[model samples]
Target: MFAGAVRVGTIDRVGIALSGLCVVHCLTSAIMLAVLASAGGILVDHRIHAIGLVLAIVLGMVALGRGIVEHGFMMPAAIGGLGLGVMAGALTLPHDSGEVVYTIVGVAILALGHDLNRRAVV
Candidate 1:
């Protein structure tokens, strides 16, 4: 039981870290694109965004699902699901301000869900 709890905690931490990275990536990419067009263009690759989205989805589902099962809390998982949906929707939109807005908002909400899950587990 203790070992499983530790594992879940680790997964939750990792999910939170990934969400943080997503936020940083979004903010930095936006700033860089606006400030240094050429350099920022190189930094903001579609592959990176896609990878981050995939990681966020996988990790969020795993960690949040575990939390819900263990704690019997639905809100965290629901919020995270909503956030994931928003982020996925962003992928289909134009790569302009709209996409950035959606990504940032989704990451924020997803991070909140992870935080809530951590608190509930504890």
Candidate 2:
């Protein structure tokens, strides 16, 4: 049981880190798009967002699923699910529109969910 808890904690941390990376990628890509438009092809790639969202979904679900089992709480999973939904919604928007804002907000919420899950585990 201790080992499983530790693994869950580790997964939560990874989820947080991934969320931070997603935020950084969104912000950096926006800045890069504004400054050096040539870099937009790589930085603003839609595939990157898709891949990141997939990762976020997987990590969030696994970590939060374990958290609910161990901690017997639903907030973390609910928050994380909301975040994932927001992220998925962002994908429907045009890249040049409010996508970045939605992505950042979703990532931040997801990171918060991860932090909450970690705290509950501890």
Which candidate has the highest TM-score of all?
Answer: 2
Task: For candidate 2, list the clashing residue pairs, or say none.
Answer: none
Alpha-carbon lDDT, every model: 0.83, 0.86
Off by over 4 Å in 1: 1-8
Residues 1-122, candidate 1: write the lDDT tens digits.
33365665677778778878888888888899999999889767888788888988888878888888888899999998999999888888876788899998898888888888888885
> TM-scores across all candidates?
0.87, 0.91
What is the C-alpha local distance difference test score of candidate 2?
0.86
Error of 2 at 65 (Å): 0.5
Give candidate 1's error at residue 106 in angstroms: 0.2
